[model samples]
Target: MAQFDVSLVLPDTLYHGSTMGAIQGLRIKPINKEFWKDAKDFGAGFYTTIDLFQATTWARKPVVAMERLNKGTDPSAMVRSLPKDQIPVVAVYDCNSNLYTDNIILHDYRGESRAWAQFILSHRHSSTVDNCLCLNEFGWIHPHIACGLMADNDTGQIIEDFRSQGRDIHNRDDLEWFWTQIIRTREGRRLNGLELGDQIAFSAKL
Candidate 1:
């Protein structure tokens, strides 16, 4: 099993001092079901990435969006311009590929299959129950590994644009393109068994 590290930059307000302390204190939790309903590719779980840049981008999103909303500006446009100080904690975790292999049900959506794309598109707007059921199924299968598409900035923008137009576009071409890139660039992996002792290291400004 290959050892890998994943990181997340959360708000500094979430912890007293260090990111490891925050994890130990049970401050890190899976994203809520409501938020998962409209989530882009993968259903909800404790999402992380091997790429620090991607992690930082994901962490800055919510904070920047809120700041723009507070300032009466369009959040989507402002997200890219948001400052890094908005997210002050970077949590890193050490993981073993062995933990993912047999211990977790790995849903690899990294292919050219239209069916896979359709599945993601269908569930992106699915009911909360349905989304939760999908995640619950993962728990029932392996309880530790949750893998799927890691939607990048371009793909996210495309999806958001379509959604804003009240159109649920499931174009296989776009889906295939994005999924291929995401799979190649930042393979999705969520450590479902993440706990305090699991993290290898962390850094926080506060």
Candidate 2:
């Protein structure tokens, strides 16, 4: 089993006390699949980033903006209105990759191969393509993992544009080209694997 020792950082500035409480209490749960389905890029699962800066941005997202974004409404203003704080704490975990054997799907977009790009587009645009089915066909749903093309305003807009246009409206070459550029600097990673404990170590506020 590939073992990973990683840290999940939650910014107190972005989340309410109760939300932080939940994380501290180990009560945080993955977003439900139904709601996650419409979520940009990969459907719902616990999301994390190896980059602390990226994670800090996620943790600092305002609740109202998050709600609006999830509802497909533009929340650019709301996002800008949110205050940035430095009170971020990290939750560390030791993960057993073996536990992900039948449960995890990796999108290794960092490579030159176009496979990850194709899979992302197909998963996003194909009405008949069920991510659950994709997971099951490969194995079982231990969890969800998206390696490349980190979700952000630019990438999110790309996804929205393609989704609004419908898969057939755009040429595959253009889509493939766009994705190739997006994943160029992305890293190979996974999320929601089997965590060994409820509480590992929490980093002091950064």
**Top TM-score prediction, candidate number:** 2
List model 1 lDDT by residue over 67-128, tens digit each. 75689766655644555434334555544444322322344443434544444444454423
Q: Record all residue pairs in model 1 with backbone atoms less than 3 Å apart, i.e. clashing.
A: none
Candidates in order have lDDT scores of: 0.40, 0.40
Q: After superposition, how far is residue 157 of candidate 2 from its true place, in Å?
A: 2.6
lDDT, candidate 1, residue 75? Answer: 63
Which TM-score value belongs to model 2?
A: 0.46
User: What RMSD value applies to candidate 2?
Assistant: 11.3
Tens-digit lDDT track of model 2 for 1-206: 67755542332221212134335343344222322333334443444444445444555555644665578655655555445432334433334444433523343344334554554454455423133334433343412445544432245556667666554414767667556444433342322222100111111110
Q: What is the lDDT for 156 in model 1? A: 54
Which residue pairs clash in candidate 2? Answer: 103-142
lDDT of 2: 0.40
Error of 2 at 167 (Å): 4.3
Clashes of 1: 0
